[model samples]
Target: MNFPRLQGMTEALRLTQAGQLNDATQLLQQLCQGQAATGPRDATVRPRRVIDLARALPKAIASGVVSPGPAAPRATVFNGTAARPANSPMPAGAAFHALTYSGPTGTRAYRLYVPASYRGAAVPLIVMLHGCTQSPEDFATGTGMNVLAEAEGCLVAYPAQPASANPQKCWNWFNANDQQRDQGEPAILAGLTRQIMRDYAVDARRVYVAGLSAGGAAAAILGAVYPDLYAAIGVHSGLACGAARDMPSAFAAMRQGGAAPSRAAAGQRTPPAIVFHADRDGTVHPRNGDQVLAQFGAGLGMKPERQDGQVPGGHRYTISRYRNGQGEPQLEHWLIQGGGHAWAGGHAPGSYTDPRGPDASREILRFFLQHRMA
Candidate 1:
């Protein structure tokens, strides 16, 4: 038994018993990494303990013994970040709601779903940022990410873009001002992450961010700005990097289109990335896919290596691994053919979603599990 982890666990237990739910949650997460790496016999002890602790947290908060953490930071309200408050209640395990720190522009709304398998111990967190015109609920329904999270014993968080910020509810990815590392929405989103850490037992090393369309662009920007925060990023049917500038440049760039400069030459702690774009994507265009793939390859300082053609889905999918100039991958690319501006292999909910072949959710999870912050 490693005493440090055991000590942390003891503190967590004491905090829980004392009704310090938020503190206890944070401590438990700190203890999880050490315990997760332990052998079977030792590992079993930690998770069981966490389950016992979770039952008491809600009670403590309800009894006024422990208050929820500070208000979530405000954000730039977009088309759907805000909705009639997630009052569309579902069963307990169906969904959980929690507000996080807001930014100067607007309030940040988030939804966390804990799988039945989650025992309150450290679990991977998947921050799914939604695209424009989409609310958290709509994204949840469209991506079917909840199903995958439940199967994998991971927690899912849907960070909403309040409609107040942008009528389209899209992440302001094209705004160059917002694209900087940890400035605008990125900073607010990081604050949301802190709130999540304070609220749940998240595995710090396994945190991941993924987005669709505008959301995808935001995810890319996130990995660049807060590379140390996210272990990996997933971009689906989105534009390349540098999509935003200021107000004027943003609209002009979006309308005229631009390429994400090759980040291959730069040296930063950029997290490994996974991009899912369809060659047939009409909205974002297939050329954007090439630019993104090339950017990753160059950023990693490695020549692009294409894989055997992907079949059966009407889309010829190609995966290229980028090894940094030092033979390390700072990025990765997944080009799906015949796929459109929708979640690949998604259900037939609408024309934009593809429900036939490889599951994008599964692939992204697999990719996340394979890498971690340097």
Candidate 2:
């Protein structure tokens, strides 16, 4: 027996028992890699166990450690860099305020951006949700949505998900409780949106939501559960609503395409949707982009009009637009040929963003402004 290796495994188990999952996972990963490279290759070496441990790491942390219910709120400081360019100046009188909203569901922190152009007239409002391990400021800086919002004279709100809720600060889109209407994270998010509307002159007809990765998945759930509130939804590198009911399934859906979205309850309309996914994305399968569009375009009997384009010195992409009988576009899907698990055409200062792809922020806003509540 390799006593030193066995000792390392025992320590890893001890760390897991102590609830130091991050440290345990790291140690296991290192051990597995070293064992694979240097350990004896005899049949007695039990290679299958090592592989199983590696595979179970994410699932152990996701499903075993965290409960599906709402976690007690923890105060987290905003420490991420903003996506604003040094050369660009904030419009005079424009402000980004950090605020909190408390409702029947719970209390959550958020950041709102009010453009200088606002002068009491109702304007479009966009609710931006950040992905796992991301702060609102980091997401803002990465996607440059604030910059575009300023130019477009729109109010942008970013809801913060604290680490206390999930160690990774991820929205629990996979949790069944979080996927329902007027319940869990959905209710909190919707309440926050309503609060913003009441406090500001928001154009109810033009309200929209967009997100990346886990936030993208949450945005899909919000659109499905509250179609009346959101004119449209943009999901980038995300799964469809009801994609997974738990952590194991969420990981499965991210690896492979998720199962078909559950049918919406009677009287609920499927909100218009725009999706962006990179063909090369390993974190969330590219097929999920197709699934999101399909969920919204189902039963519409509309065929998509396809267009191919390339970014200047960057990636090649294909755009498919699904139009209604009256020629109104109800769904749009963008597939970046060589993109990964990052925001396409995003700024470098923020995490999980690709600067060379098509400008997803500008494109999503363009798609959003085209639709309003009917």
Candidate 3:
């Protein structure tokens, strides 16, 4: 650990011992942000690594300060109870299998949805990462991705983020370790995608990834770091890759807006991207949506073809489509007017959904199908 980080931690420990838990948490968050801004002095040191609050503080203090708050009730298959209605009834021959993938980083459980129409033929694969405090079933139900998969004969994978990794079960997109290729969560998720492709017949060029909130941010990072693995990405209410490097910065980015994305490297081809964000989002500032597209090169002097539409008896929205030099659509951004921080046009059974907006799932899948790896 860096000397300043160590000193800050010691100060936080003292504050915690003095029964100032909130102050300690704030201090720790500041320390995290400072570390991210300055980076490590040693090249070998990984900056913005995930902090283990439990090991750093008393159990009570860690429990209260580390997590945002008490998570909502989690939906578990073991209990045989439904937290929400199934996204849709499974068609005959369709299968939802729970599987696990272990890699050098760690092990994670994931759920795969195989559409009924899938035979031995190769089909497009979509990896869906759920938001914080959400389960695969809940996300599948909320986003209605599996139903779309069934209708379109696409394979969908939902990677589960356990509470052990994050108390809120959020992808650690803010951490430097988790943001890089072949490291932390990115490696696990990419490995999982490859494992699915190996286990089932999947179109190599048509593999895509999408997610909501923290998962959405993770999707952006994955697209940035592993463009060869994912042909396209869908980020709903997410920030740009490298938007923030720690908890304080994450919170700041969510509240206001994050720093501009770093320029893309030479010879790097960022995957085509589709982003969705509400103009009225309270939890995540809508500016983050623009940053997401900008990270994909949307801000590189390319003009977008803008369109506007409204859902029947629902929210109005604006779409800005950007094209590459060859006139190929490269980025699409959806801004839902009067929409909050939830999945647009999502089902009611799932958590954090706004049913009164355009169906994000349908649009995202359509966008994904339009592009593939060259």
Q: Which candidate tops lDDT?
A: 3
> What would the per-residue lDDT of candidate 2 be over residues 1-374, giving only the tens digit for each residue?
87777776766665554444444555666676775222222213211100011122353343222111111111111112233461266788999999999999889999999999999999999999998778999899888888889889999999999977877788888889998899999999999999999999999999999999888999999998899899999999888988888767776787677888675566677788999998877567788888888778744688888999887667789999888777888889999887777787787767777777688888899999989998
**Number of the top-ranking candidate, with TM-score as the measure:** 2
Provide C-alpha RMSD values for all models, in order. Answer: 23.0, 8.4, 9.9
Candidate number that wins on TM-score, 1 or 2: 2
Query: Quick one: ranking by TM-score, best first?
Result: 2, 3, 1
- Candidates sorted on lDDT, descending: 3, 2, 1
Model 3 has an lDDT value of: 0.79
Error of 1 at 60 (Å): 54
- Among residues 3 or more apart in sequence or in different chains, the pairs in candidate 2 whose N, CA or C atoms overlap within 3 Å are 83-141
- Against the true structure, what is each candidate's TM-score? 0.68, 0.81, 0.79
Give the better candidate number (1 or 2) by lDDT.
Answer: 2
- Per-residue C-alpha lDDT of model 3 across residues 162-221, encoded as one tens digit per residue: 988987688888888998999999999999999999999999999999999888999999
Per-candidate Cα lDDT values, in order, are 0.62, 0.77, 0.79
Task: Please give, for residues 1-374, the per-residue lDDT of candidate 1 as tens digits.
Answer: 67777666666655555545455555555555545322222222222111011122223232122122221112221111221121233435555566567766446888887777766799889899887667777777656677767777888889888766665577878777677765788888887886787788998988999988778878877876777789988888665678545444343333334545546336566677788876655445555555555544443336766784543423457787776667655556777655555666544432235554356777788888787755
Candidate 3: where are CA atoms >4 Å away? 1-86
